[model samples]
Target: MSIAKKLVGQTAAYGLSSIIGRVLNYLLVPVYTKAFLPEAYGVVTYLYSFVALFNVLYTYGMETAFFRFANKPGTDQRELYNKVLSLIGSSSLIFTAILLLASGPIANFIGFPERQEYIVWLAIVLAIDAIATIPFAWLRLQNKAVKFASIKLINIVLTVGANMFFLVFCRQVYNGDYLPELRPWVTSIYNPDFGVGYIFLINLVANALQLPLLWKELSIFRFRLDVDQLKPMLRYAYPLLFMGLAGMVNEVIDRILLEYHLPDNFYPNMSNMAAVGIYGACYKLSIFMSLAIQAFRYAAEPFFFSQANDKNSPQAFAQIMKWFVISCAFIFLFVSAFRDEIASVFIDESYHSGLVVVPILLLANLFLGVYYNLSVWFKLTDRTQFGTWISVGGAVVTIMLNLLLIPVLGYVGSAWATLCCYFAMAAVSYFLGQRYYPIPYPVRSIIGYIVLAVVLLLGVFYVPVQQVWLNYLIGLVVCALFLVIVAARERLLFFNK
Candidate 1:
């Protein structure tokens, strides 16, 4: 299949899971936002942030290593897969066991002393997901896009269905079906009146469904472990561990810090917690850009490894990067043009304060997508440390900005901090990639798109289109103008035709 066709297919497969999954996930926003108070939702947000952190830790760097060594000559791909799979599996079991035993202390450390069951159940869920990462990675490497996407879609659908049943449908039918299973600790601390245990119970059920689906991928491993190959792969993957942690830190630290910095009196003001919840909810709307980036990363990483030895690999990389730029620019305009409307679907009107942060976060995601494109250079060259340093630098920028600005600017400050982090990271990585392994990317044409997007966005933001339909019409005109500029400057239309 042609690259374009394959990319289209892959995008569709990914879009099926990501877009559909997110649409179902969006159901939870209204469910939680309406069912639970903002403070309660904030606890959900805080714990999920820790889940994101632990996901990075548990999966570590094996996914990338699998892609790297799986393509190398003389490497027993099956054995290599088994080794990493075994490593992640054993480590997850040990870690989950440890967390289970220490659930009390862990809950206390995170200021959830009364909700140790939350810690324990979620730890099990996370470990299962973490262990599944390798098989999922294998599926991607083998281009089993349909099967991969199906499993993902089912997982989300089951999760959403379960959540709805527990949070909505089953609430009225609450019998003594499982009340005895609730521990004294849970009964004492948790309000049985609220019926919040359903969240964890539903997650537990949905994650367990993956075991049967994963059996096919697990069966592919027939070769035994090779300690010799393990050493070098570990050496290569260790830096990536730090890089992943730093990258996630940049992504998640704001939420963590917000919870940490919030004062005791802040809880009485629903607006304060509401602002955070609103920001978190609307931020998920930016998944359009993130979804594209993730889909590309899934395809591109393995594509890069497979083609790294080709004589024209650099040119291929440059071409793909250019098209990625065009597509991302188009997505940015498409999302921004309708964000005023899109924001409403994510939450009730009470959360509208978050609208101001949406464009900034969307633009930040564009920069992040670009950074992901540029990062391939370092990964291919085995200079993984460069990526780590770049992320750390970006994290520093993000931290300092949030620290100085959040108190003054509120959620908008966090938005700007994110923007700065991605912008700086992309800029730094582009320059470093050129120095280490230059690709003659069309800088002038790319900048033209950037400039046009900024100008058009400014017009959308400033122009007074009070009527919702009229504003959408105005946005379409601005978007068309950006596209025309891109076509004219790059002759994209002529070349495609």
Candidate 2:
């Protein structure tokens, strides 16, 4: 098969799980909003933001490291797998213990002293999920996308099921909508006092459910350390640890910072949680873009490492970057054009005010996706520290921007900070990639595509049609025009009919 076809197939398998999994997760937003207040939902968002950071620390770049070493000629795949599993397993346990011991102090520091269980639950969730990372990466390496997708789908289903059981069924029973006989059972299990805590509990339960499926991956008995082998792997992965952490900071710290830095005076009538809730809801509008990026990353990382030795690898990478950019652009235009309709699908009315940032966030994610593609340069060349520098710079951008702007512009400022950080990161990565591992990245054409997308998005925004149907018709026509122009300009690949 052609490399393009293989990439598409692998990406489709990964995307099926990623995109479908996220869409299903997205469908739960309305349920969460209904079951918990904006304040409560905001708390959920806040804790998960911390989870995002902790997840990186817990896994600590082993997944990528595993792929890098495992794909090499001299490395023993079995020994590599055993050492990685043992390393993460020991660290995860240790981390979870420390978190548990310090849960009280940490909860207080984070302004949630009253809800220490949130800390405990997240600690457990992160640990389990962290240790499980390698097995999932193993599935990817093995070309078991079907199994990967199935396991992912199952994990999400169990999570959603657990969420519904708690939020939907138990809530109805508590509200006296259910028959009185079932009350005893439901009431014993359900506590109105739990509130958003149930969300955490359900998540912990869902992550735990994934363990039994990985019996084969985990059954090995290689608990002994190989110091010689471990040294180089650690050296290779350490920079990535920094890179991943900073990257996550770019991704999630806005939600965390919003909770802290939001002015008491901004959103005068609403509490901090309310402001955060609004911002968090609108952020969901960018998930489709994230989903696409994640799917591509899953396939691309292993796929790229495998093809690194091929004579045509550079050209292939360049074409992949072009198509990747085009795909992200289409997503940006689609979401920005229909954002009014799309934003309302699962978000509550209270969150509507913050939806203005949806397009900004989508575009930001596009930049992030591009940066990920450019990052292949560093990863391939084993100059991974460059990634650390770029991401750390982005993280600095994130912190400084949030500190400066969140007070004045509220969550909207946070959104702008995100877009700026990603834009800077993508540009910097591209320049760095050119210097170190130059691939003919079609720079002019990529700029043209991005500019055209922005212009079309502006037209969609300003030239608003009155009828909903008419607006959708306009969006479709604009999408077609963008496609035709792109195809006409670059008929070498996508439009070569």
| Most TM-score-accurate candidate | 2
Pairs in steric clash, model 1 = none
Note each model's CA RMSD in angstroms.
4.5, 1.7
> What would the per-residue lDDT of candidate 1 be over residues 1-497, giving only the tens digit for each residue?
24444555666676677777767877788777666666567677777878888888888787898899888889877777888888888889999999999999999998879888898889899889987888888888778888888898899899898777666544433433455454443445444465556677678778878878889887876544565757888888888888888888888877777765544454345555555676677777777888778777767777777777767667666666777777788788778878868766756666665677877888898889889889988999999989989988888998888887777677688889999999999999999999998887777777777767877888888897678788888888988887777677667642232
Best by lDDT: 2
Q: For each of the candidates, give the backbone clash count.
A: 0, 0
Using alpha carbons, what is the TM-score of model 1?
Answer: 0.90
Q: What's the distance in Å from true for residue 105, model 2?
A: 1.0
TM-score of each: 0.90, 0.96
